[model samples]
Target: MTSLSTSKLLALLALFVWQAHASLANSPRSLPARDEFVCPAEDIANTGCLGPKDCLYANPNNCNTFIRCIANADGTGTPVVLPCLLELEWNDNKKECDFPENSTCPPK
Candidate 1:
C-alpha cells in the first residue's frame, strides 16, 4: 500500500466531503419548505462563546434586539447588543434581523 502524506490525505478527505455535500445540496428532497422550518428551543439570551468563533444569540426579552458575540484571541466572546431597523426584529430561526411580522419570537 502506498503511504500518503498527511496533507494529501486531508485534501482527499475534504474533496470527498465537498462532493457529498454538493450532491446532497442538489437533491430535491434534501431541503424542507421554508414554512416547515423549526427554531431551536434553547433560550439564547446573554449567551457567549468559549471557543474561537463568533456567535449570534437571540434576545428572549426583546425581539427587536439581538446579541452578536465577537470572538477574541483569548478564546472568549464579547457580546454586543444590536437593534433591528425600524419595523424589524431579530428572527432567531433565520439568525438575522427581519421584519417583525416574519419573526418567530413572541411579541415584545
Candidate 2:
C-alpha cells in the first residue's frame, strides 16, 4: 500500500483504540445506582409470610440505622438499599441477601 494510505490506516486504528479505551475506562465497575430495590425481611426468611420473620428480627433498642446496598444480576445500573438487619441467612448458591419478593431486607 502507499505510504499515505498506510499512515491514514494507522491513524484510524489508533483513534479506534483510544475511543475503546476511553469508553472502557468510563464504564461503571459496579451496578448502577438506579436499578436496585430493598428486600423485605419476610422474603429473606423464605417463610412465605408478609409479617416480620422471627428468625430475622432485630432489637429495636440496640439497632442501628445504617443501610446496605446490593446489585442485581442484570447489567442495568441499579442497586437495592437494605436496612442493616440482625440475622442474615446464608444460601450457599445465592447472593448475600436474596429476598424472593423484595430486594431490600428490613433493618434489624
The best candidate in terms of lDDT: 1
Model 1 ranges off by over 4 Å: 1-54
Model 2 segments more than 4 A misplaced:
31-108
lDDT of 2 by residue, 1-95 (tens): 99999999999999997786456434434323333334354343443332322123221222221122222333221222233223333222333
RMSD each, Å: 15.6, 17.9
Put down candidate 1 lDDT per residue, 1-108, tens digits, no spaces: 345687789899899977864564233221123233222223223333433222665765567766655545554444555566555787877777788788978755
Cα error, candidate 1, residue 94 (Å): 1.3
Worst lDDT window (10 residues) for model 2?
A: 58-67
Task: Tell me the TM-score of each prediction against the true structure.
Answer: 0.47, 0.29
* Highest TM-score against the true fold, candidate: 1
Candidate 1 TM-score to native: 0.47
